[model samples]
Target: MHGHYRETAECPGQTRGESSGGTHLQMHGHYRETAECPGQTRGESSGGTRLQMHGHYRETAECPGQTRGESSGGTRLQIHGHYRETAECPGQTRGEREGRVVDGLTSKYMDTIERLQSVQARLEVKAQTLERESNECRVQTEECQQQLRKCQSELNRQVKQSSCVIQEKVPFNDTKTSDYNSLNVPPHNKRHQLKARDVAGQALGFVQDIVVALLNFHSYTEQRVHIYPLDSSIEPISPLNQKFSQYLHENAAYVRPLEEGLVQLHQSITEDTVTVLETVGKLKDFAEHFTSYTHFLQKILPYQLKSLEEECRAPLCTSSLISKNQELQSGMKRITSVFDKLHRYIILLALPSVRQDAMPQSSSSAVFTQLAACLHSLHDAIKEMSKHYSQKAGLEQQLPTVTQKLCTTNECLLASLGMLTNSTDKIATFFSNNLDFFTSSTGYGPRGGVGVLNPLQAESMLGNKKKASDYMQAIRKPRAESVPYREALLNRRVLTSSTESRQGLTQQVVASQEKIARLEQEKEHWLLETQLGRVRLEKESQRIQDLETQLSSALEGGGGSPASALSLGLGSPALTSLDDGELEERGVEKDAMINTSLVGMLTTTPTNEEVRDEESREQLIKTHYMARVGELTTQLQVSDSKAVNFHAECRALAKRLALAEKSRETLTEEVKLANQNITRLQDELATTKRSYKEQLSMMSDHLCSMNETLSKQREEIDILKLSGKGNSKLLKKGR
Candidate 1:
């Protein structure tokens, strides 16, 4: 045992493999402590540097006291990716005459293989480092490319501005025929005029680009105003608060004063809390309600939501599913509306709004339960479908991008989550463990990507998904553009890209000078700010002195004096921003207030040294020069444009005069034709008058004839009358 050395590197790695066994034996032959391996295979440690091996776990055993102590991590060894288990050490290891039992050829071959493997490993390590560097370079390259893009955009903008300037300087009529004009315009003016027109189109596009950027900036500010607040729960005039107070007022039919809104809010909160608790307290068990529709929560609701499945199972159709989800959302809204009031006291994590919910007894647990059931059902469904939906099929259809939960770095869909999305919240609840990552929408699933479904917007979004193809539009369609970003604001992406732009380096000399001036002003402002802070600090010190005096007097007076004298009259320091020794003392004083008479005696405040700091800061911003620069640029552009207009106007006016003369000549001809038409019409009118008079005379002659005939008839009638009288006499005689 004293003359033997055995190689065992079984924990995970090996250096030189079995090939160097012969070499090892030759080297240790003279050393009495070296022992030949029973298997005639062992390698000298490869520079004694540990190498990590990645492969299936393999075991090789070495007896105690036989090893030279070169071991991986266990009493085992492997050679050339081959594992072999050795028995307990042979008792005759010392007596064994190793007369080259291992053939030199085989030993040499193994040694060669091991050397190659070692070389390969080193190469692999080198490759890994190279790959890491490559990735870093690639990232830097991408950043450079982005900066290049911004540079290009800015360059395009400058070109467009120059074009616009030239276009403005060279006046041209928009209505002028663009085909060809050789009247009064020379070729030089015409060439510039043509360039202006041609470049104006590109300028217009550049202007649109700038406008879009401005709009995006405007929206960014809007989002900051609405969402980027640490204390968002305390908005006095928030719409939700207004709605709460308004609802309270309407509920009791009382128009209370604005100052009492907080009192009203507290009353409402108390009433709602007590009502919800009482409603739940009366219930002996929640098992019955959990079961009534628990199955749907699992098997139907969430599955349909994730898939936007229209063809429902036996019990639920699309319409019923939609209606149920709407009802569920309504319940959730109510629950959130009630419990959301508690966020005022919750110091750690809280959403601006929770999108909370409830079930019968209206307990939040039921809401939570139903959400769990839906997710469990969805997950189970996924598992079942995963059985049938082959990986090959998934790859071919590109389904994982559309269906799998996002923000997971792992390749396999629905298999394992790399991390929880709500790790920031760190909240423990009934469903925290089992249901945290239940579904895509609820709990700790990816909520930010383009196709991510929000639990609050699930109903409308799913409905839209079923009926429409525009999922991004549907997901983003919220009341405020910022509404879609609210949860993201709370649960933001932890990893952020570094920002840089090429635009700064490309600024004009004026802009650079302006920036220099701005920095100088900022330096002055900071100096002034320090002075102001000193004044405020002095005022705080004065207030502290007064409080100390009041406290001392209170201690001296004891319980015998008035309550006013007993008051400690402590007021917190006004200058919280300063981090100097005095402010640290102030902070220490605040900490000291934690234990004593400092609590109740906080009424007194020193005279406020600054009331208009915000306004003062605004006034100090020195943007007038920047604006003046723009105005001067505009005026220069206008002045140049006016001079260009004089020349352009002369030619244009000359052309217009020619056109006007031609128009006037045409008008004279038209007037002559119109007069001829009028004279012809008058002659026709006279003929018509004469014809009318002739017809009237003819009609009168015909009337005279008609009168004479009537008279003749009258005379005949008289004759008849005389005959009738004779006839009547004859008739009387006959009678």
Candidate 2:
């Protein structure tokens, strides 16, 4: 077994041919040894050798050159086939065959091993190619994913940028619109009016832009915005323009009424204040007069008192007691009179001043003058009282001492009234200052400019314009020759309000009347419309009743079909719900009955009694038909007239069109001619210019030529003269 393993191990490392050769060599060696042996001479030795070789060959064929030890190791089993045939082994046919068999087995085994190795190599190469392909696919997939990510990011960025752009532009456009809406100031000055017109145009442009943007937006909100007309004012402000609308809404309450009321109140109060100032002036006058009267009375009093004393010393004061009593009584009367007059004067002074201060400015002039006159009268009365008081004072010295008391009361009352006037003046001054403040704040600038009487001045100008127009109208009147100009002027006064107070009242009345008239006109218009509507409704109702009667008759007759019934029921509201079958039967019956009734009615028409009735009915029907025909004829006539007029108008229009066309043609021809003329003129002008330039150049050349010729001639002349002189000198020399 060890020798077999060594032989198999060597056989595995060596080619089959080499191993077979070695086996032949071994067999040959064995045969040589055996041939030399005694067993070779004997037949027993040959049989044993042959059997042994045969066994070995069978084993080699079975295991394919595998020895026992080589099989046990089982790792280095690779071999190639090697054939052996033999002359070296003389009696070794079995060994040689065994070697051939082993060689065939080994060759078969080697072929299988080579095939398996080739399959393994092919599989490994396929796996390597698959791995490389898979890796490349993965890299490409990763690259595609990166590109997708980059595209997604760029798309997102563009989306965000587009959204931002839309947002910015949308708000900017809305803000511009809001600015326009807020600043809808009135146009006063020419520049402002132009600016306002420009703003309106700009606003329209913005609106158009907004409309376009909304269309582009393609959103529900934008679609809804478009449902309303762009020019519609009723829509609420857009989100972007809300700020200005909100501002207008929030501040509207604060501004409008207060400003208007303040203006009106300022004008009213200023007038009142002016009245108060005039009243104060009146009071001042009264007070001055009162003071003067008091002085005059003081000077006149003594003389009047002495005269009273002298008069009292008559027969009525004969006895000493009677005369003295009478004197005392007379003195008391005088003092009482003086006191009464002084009290009356003081009261009058106080009241006139108070009234003057309280009177309305418009009435102030009259009131002031009246108060002044009353004060003057009171002053005279006070002078009379002072005279009586002075007389009483003289009498008091003689009889009683009470006159001085009366004089003191008069002085106190006069002084008190004087103080009252001073107070009024102060009050007037305060009011005047307040009026100035008020005028500046509310009455001037916006309402009327600059001065207190600006409104009045404007009114007066308007009045003058009216008067001038009236005067012109009067002068233009053919019959005005009978009416004096002054009379006409006087009559014109009636057309205007006489007083400021009356004028204001009349203005309010006129305004109220105008409002009432407008309302009445609207009411009358509505009433007329209502009446017309009612008349149409009544006519419709009557026609409906007649139709209903006819429908009822048809339904009752019940002969004809529902369609006929329905035809009879035309204009009838009463038979609206009649079903088809019922209506049909009713219509048939109604048609038959109507036909018979018409026949009977016609039968009566041929008889004398019926003839009259038939004639009247025929006349009525004929009249109605004639009236209808007349109406139709009138309508036809009207239509024909209209057509004629229209035809004439069309002819006129055609004439005008022809004229316009002719004008246009003329204008076109003129324009063409003008263009031709312009071209011709341009060409002529150019040619003339060229010609002029050529002529100028030619003239210049001619002048230059002439100048050159003249110079040459002069040079020739000089040369000739020189030559002559030289020749003469030569001649002289020769001589």
Candidate 3:
């Protein structure tokens, strides 16, 4: 029979043998020598070959080649070549060589298979580790994207709100000038006067009352009027009252002088008609001068008084007061000159006439003297009036310093207020600039590029306009669109999260499938190993049966030696039964021992209970797994609910954003309307101011025209008076 043997120096306890006669054997430790194989020294001689084969196997196992198929084929070829060389000796038969080659091929094939399995296991482990890392990377990427979206949304919202607030805060300053203009117009018309005819008529009426009173006095006293007090009620009072009373007493005493002067005038008139006419002409001239004087007083004095009062009350500048004082002094000089002319005219009229009248000389002389005295009193009254005006002017002069101080204080206050307003405006501008900086610095659209909006950009877009409502509306339109844009972005984020979750779930399922596949492969490998062990055990049993049959055959042929017989009979039942008592004793002993061992086993190894415990543990594990699954399901449901709530909140936020956008739009529209109204009002104010200016110009032109006309009329009157004088002189010369 041909046999193959394997020897491993590293594992001395294990041995394998294969026979061409259909006997395959495996052994552990040293094998006992059998009598049939006493001459065979094959085991010792094959040890070197077995050591070589083990070294080859070790080499193949330690340094695995990249290509399994090629390496295995090459190793098989090398083993076949080694076996062929070993079998190629001259004395070797073809059968042994073929069996050796077949054995070497089988050994090499087993090594290749083991190497492939180990390589596959390592690859599977690496693949699982890589998949886990990839899943972690995916989760981190998703988290980062979500964070980015949140930051972007928050930034956009803040920018929009800031822009809205900025749009809401712009100011208008044209109304103040209009108010000031309206307040200053009344003082100009306050100084205008009534017509000259009306003033002259009033003066004429006053003259007529005076003339009637004088005539009544002359008739009642029979051309003699007493200068004393008429009643006890008359008394010295205030200076103004005392002056008037003294004038009345003096007028009463002067009535006699006036009668005497009138008697002298009557005698002159009776003596010569020419003299009478000349005297009448002189009286007419005096009347004309007095009437002119009264007209001047009535028409001009009140305006001058009002002007002086206004100047005194007003807080005019020092330079203006000084100019006004000079004007007043000049006017007083003019008035004093007119009074002196009237005084000379009065004295000339009071002189004794060239021709005497028919009346008493004494009465005429008394009348002339009384009239002169009355004229002197009138001159004194004029001087007093001038003095009163001078005193008023002086009083007004004293207030110039106070008025100047007040003006300076007012100017300083106005300047301070202006400075404060300017400073506040500058502070607002600084804050606005800061806001613009923040707005501009914030990133918006994409890839950290330029921002969506900034205050400076908005202002620039609005083109330096005072009103930015239109620009705000334009901005709002885009911002309104951002609501939907943000919603879409949120939806996309949700979808991406769901997709990532699904990918994670799929990855988990794939990992689980890989684990299940690896477990199934392990189970199949274990079952194959168990089947190989069972087949090896059965082969060994068959080999032992064959050995027993051969021994029996040798004994039956009567060729077996006694020793061989003894050796064979060692396993026979008859020999074993011959010592029954001792065997029985031993058997009893064995049975007792076995029984004790069984009892010990029964006591020590509670297999059923252990199995029950294991099953309970499994049940507990299953229950725990189920509870975990339930918790996870509940968590998933809660997460879904949270997602739904988040979606609802996002929707609500979107609605609020939309409402805010609408409100912003409304505010922008209102602002636009307000801007339009302000512009319209400014235009109206401008037009009104232009009209007022034009009206003032027209009034000034008309006043100048009226002044020129009055001057021309006065010049014409003077010319006419000169012509009348010349004509009268010519007429008098012709007569």
Candidate 4:
């Protein structure tokens, strides 16, 4: 068997030698044929020769044709000799040539397997790194979401608290009390009450005097008749008299209306005086109610809120709510103070008996002065009426026009007085609205509601309602010319107030938009970072897949032992050198045992068991890499999805923010325009007030001059009557 094995191995070697020599001879013959061809150039011949040499070198390197010590020329000669011997030997088999080809392919496959294993190891390390990074990114995302939720909750809480506070603070009622007690003035000392009563009595007396004077003037004017006859020589003799007669004729049409207006003025003043007296009586009761309400706010509401907060411990149980409650209390105190000042102003204006030494000049004083001016004008008109009836200075026509103007001025003053009284109604409304705050169980009051008005206080409230109704009725009544003026003023005020409200709303919208914008920007940044992380994870996954593909290719191509594949060129330089030494030693041993083992090594296709083992190991490695790649891919996909969701949310928030910003900008512009309108209205109001004051001053001056002229005329009439009486007695004696 040994002799047969040796012969078989020798036969294959001799066959390989013959095949290599025959191939070389064919190459040389082809080169010679190319060189000898008529169509072949020198460059083509040289190129063909070089190509043959390169092929020979590659063949020798892949499957050694001769010993390493042999020169190229000697090796060729030996190869030719061996080829002659191999052709004559006649014992070579085809299987031997196939085995040699398979061995060469297996060696090349081993190199590829080594490279694939190395790549696989690197991919695994990279995948592990990516996994760690992805985990970190996930943790960061979770943390960010947690923070966002916390911030949102906090903002909502703050908004709720602010809205609640604003609702509690805004007063919605408009009530005014003329009585000092109604304004919560302390009545412990009767001195203030006595003072108030004295002031009211004095104001009533003044109103009575004005009423009496107006009535007398009306009766006197109604009785006066100017009869124009051809008998009297009462012609306008001088230029001044002619001018006065012209004015009298021009203003004659106003006489009847002036008389009617004066009657209405007297009636209105009388009614206003009665209303004031009635309001005075209720002031003490209103004051007591207001005091109780303030006490409830300052003492009861806080205590209730504290108890509720202690019980609930909700988000509403914050210091800010307490602070707002305190602010409300302070505002109530301020309202009380303003009410007191207003009450004192009313007293000063109404009561001439009250000491005016300490009374500061204020709007009330201006109103009083204007009222006095109206009375003075009415007194001058009465004197002018008397002068007209006497037919002295031809001033009857002028008197009617001046009297009409005086009556109009008095009407304006009465309207102003009504407004002044109505102005105090705001204090009552403020008190009522504030008192209502305690009525709400969820707002400032306890479970058992407080701040409610008692039945005893209902009587005082009835007066307020009556007064308001009366005032409203008065307003509803038709005033021929004043209606348009009042409407214009009201429209202007409404425009200004609406503009102010719009501005406030705009500011709130702007602030909300800014908050939304900040949130959106933060969300966008987080999404961008997450997307980058996902991209990194995907890149790692792709690398892992690439490594897996290479590993699979190596496993398919290399049918070598797994140990050889794993250990081949995949270590530190020292380890690689040691592996090289071992491989060389194994090669020497294999060469020495070639005669015995060549057939076994070459003819033995890897045993099914070994092949299966290698394939399974390769599969295991591939599966491991693929599993890692899959895990990374899954992580990438999950991260990508998360990033996508975050991006979508960010985009939505951005859109909302942009809308809010646009709204805020529009509102801001509106606010600016509203402010401008308000300024313009204020300027107009100031101008009107100034012009009215000037007209009043000019009329007052004219009234003083008219009063002086009437006194002189009355003296002249008395002098003329005494002289006529003396002349009549003498004439009687003469008769």
Best by lDDT: 2
* Model 1, CA-based lDDT: 0.40
**Is candidate 1 or 3 superior in TM-score?**
3
Best by TM-score: 3
lDDT of 3 at 209: 31
Error of 3 at 701 (Å): 2.1
Q: Candidate 4: misplaced stretches above 4 Å? A: 1-619, 653-657, 717-735
How would you encode candidate 3's per-residue C-alpha lDDT over 1-735 as one tens digit per residue? Answer: 111222122223322211211111111111222222346577763564455445655754565433444543444555565556556765765578689989999999999999999999999999999999999999999999999999999999999998887678734322234322222211111111122223223333323333334434323222111111111134432333333333434333433333333333333332112221112323433434454444433443443334344444445435655455456545645554554555454444433232222233234434444444444444444344434434443544465344443334333333333332232333233333333221231111111222122211322322322234456567777444345888999999999999999999999999999999999977755554444335435655786697678777868877779667656655566354455478568546644543343211212335554354335544544665698799999999999999999999999999999999999999999997797567546755775798799999999999999999999999999999999999999999999
What would the per-residue lDDT of candidate 4 be over residues 1-735, giving only the tens digit for each residue?
223223324334445454456456655566657744759887887686666656654555555445433433454776677568658856755577578889999999999999999999999999999999999999999999999999999999999998888779855322232232232211122343343344434333333333333333323222221111110144423333233233334332322333333333333332223222222333333234334433322433333333323323323233543443344344334433443443343444433212222232234335444434433333333333333223321222233333443344334333333332222222233223333221222121111332322223334554554577688799999878755888999998999999999999999999999999999977755554444335435655786686567556665678666555545423435345566578679546643543243211322347553354345444544665698799999999999999999999999999999999999999999997797567546755775798799999999999999999999999999999999999999999999
| lDDT-superior candidate, 1 or 2 | 2
Better of 2 and 3 by TM-score: 3
TM-score for candidate 1, please give it: 0.13
In candidate 2, residue 386 scores what lDDT? 39
Which runs in model 2 stand beyond 4 Å of their true positions?
A: 1-621, 624-628, 644-670, 729-735
Q: Against the unseen true structure, what C-alpha lDDT does each candidate score? A: 0.40, 0.49, 0.47, 0.48
TM-score-wise, the better of 1 and 4 is: 4
Report the lDDT tens digits of candidate 2 across residue range 532-633. 335435655786698778877897798888777876666345345666687688657644543455311433325453455445545655665588799999
TM-score of each: 0.13, 0.17, 0.19, 0.18
- Against the true structure, what is every candidate's RMSD? 58.1, 60.0, 72.5, 69.8
